[model samples]
Target: MKVLHIIPSVAKVRGGPSKAVIEMVKALRSQNVDAEIVTTNDNGKDLLDVPLDILTDRLEEYGNVPIRFFSRFSPNLNAVREFAYSGALTAWLWQHITDYDIIHVHAIFSYASTIAMAIARIKNVPYINRPLGQLCEWSLQQSKLRKQIYLNIIERSNLLHSQSLHFTAEQEREEFHQLGLNIPNFVLPHGVHIPEPIPDAQDKLRQILQIPHQIPIILFMSRIHPKKGLEYLIPALSKFQDSNFAFVIAGNGESDYMNQIQDLLEKHRISDRTHLVGFVNGETKNLYLQGADLFVLTSHSENFGIAVIESLAAGTPVLITNGVAISPMVKEQDLGYVAQLDSEAIASTIQEFFEHPQVAKQKGDRAQQYIAEHYSWAKIAHSLINIYAKYAKYTKL
Candidate 1:
């Protein structure tokens, strides 16, 4: 079966959705299905340079997968919209949709999703839409006025027309009902490819971050955005007078907002205790995870915390706010703490974990075992295949 996965970009820098699509497609191929990526990324190149050398290498790496780069001359700023509306792009996708057994749409509330919606409708093909957390009320409220207009017209129609919807967690599915939007759906968790242990990762990460070997490092590996609750975490870090622990903020986001977050750190007079490492990937990311005493996410609302599960895979306990949809996993696996969104609650959990180091490590071990058994990409891919096969066979193309 040929499965075409649609995402705005396959760029690793775009974070979770890109990573999720890559892992899912890779996993499907391993299971003897012919899977490919159909993205607006055009080799995932940066707008200014659009370096052919780098783009060539990227395409070469995934040579087996067919990539159709549409409208090389389109403006990069609104590439999503441009791609969705382009007659050439629409014609190309419409012509190809019938050749594939399933079209998997990732990240709704985007131009690509609208195009996927249109194509599925015209071709009579079965396409699955993965909201990837955009369906949550809080996420929608972020652009209240604009999204309200978009939803009333474009988004709502696209959603209703899709073959089936895919959710990252049951919480997200339930949240959709609260929004008064109902559609056929499946709940599947994002999966991780467990990385091999880093040699002396703890010491290596400490040295790289200029953190002392004695300080207990708490790691937050995610985009540094306002929705992530970094503003809450940064201030809460100041309240902890204990000198033995340090907070490492790794990841990047909008420049102006990131500067404001930095100013928050300086204003709290805890800048010395906090280190911001721009963005780390591959072994470096694992090193930061292994070096940490614990992992924490204080997001306002998360569809799924892939980072939380990844932290557990690295044998690091996670302390997440209730806003994360995967808090159930934390509870079931005995991972770490789950508190409300307040600064006091976050600080209190950090203190408690520090107070009982042995129990904390035991929880971390249990988390590793749980994620190993449940959240591998192999398991997630199989579930996705089942969801696709259900609609694909019944819909007859």
Candidate 2:
């Protein structure tokens, strides 16, 4: 089967959606499915020197999957940040929409998604819409006016017309149902790539960051966005000022948001205890995960916390709030601690882990085993192929 994936960008800095697309495509190809991607060059404000190296409009190989990148008409638009507005990309989709058996568009309210879905409909091609946590209650509340306008203007129709709405978790599917949209839903959790253990990872991380060997590290490794509930985490962690723990926040965000985080650190008087290591990727990212005593993600609403799984894969126990869709799994499997969204609850959980170091280590070991057994990309890809086959056969009928 031939599948075409349309996304805004695959730049590493774009976070989970980009990573999801790349990993999913690679996995699909390994299952003997012909998978390809078409995206725009949307590097956002904080561009990470990613090698685009585009020589033509034709497809180029990014790893094993083929991909095409189009240049945006207006690169900068304060009103619509991180959006890819490319006439060339839309034209290409129009010309080739019928070539694929399935069109999987990741993320909603973007030019890529809207145009791809519109063209796919005209060509009578079945398309699946992956909102990537956009439909959650917390997400809907942000930029309410703009989202409402977009919903009425384009997104509502784009959503209704799709063959299926893909959700990474049941929590996300339920949230989408709350929107009153009558659409077929498919729930498939995103997979993770479990890395081999690095023997010197902890030592390397400590040396690079200038952190002492004895200090316990609580790591937060995601985009520094308000939705991450860092405002709550900072204050909760402030209660640990007297503790021998170091809070390392290893991601970048808007300048204003970064300033807000810095302000929170100062206000809590934990500036000396907290370290902002900026955006980390590649080996540095793995080292941080391997080196950390514990990993924490206090997102207000996450469809699937990829970092949570990554932490587990790194053999580090996680501490996450109920807002994370995977929190139930963490709690049920004893992979980590699950707390209420309250700062007090989060703070108390951290204290529990600190008090019981041996329990934390056991949990971390369990987490690694669970992730390896259950969250393989190959298994996830096979399941997705079955779903596509079912839908594709129905479309033919």
RMSD of 1: 3.2
- In order, the Cα lDDT scores of the candidates are 0.77, 0.85
lDDT of 2 by residue, 25-120 (tens): 989988888788888777776343333434232333245467777776554666555566788888888888888888899998788888898888
Question: Model 1, stretches more than 4 Å misplaced?
Answer: 42-67, 71-88, 393-397
- Model 2 residue runs over 4 Å out of place are 46-64, 393-397
C-alpha RMSD values across all candidates: 3.2, 2.7
TM-score of 2: 0.93
At residue 248, candidate 2 shows an lDDT of 96
The number of the candidate with the highest lDDT is 2
lDDT of 2 at 195: 87
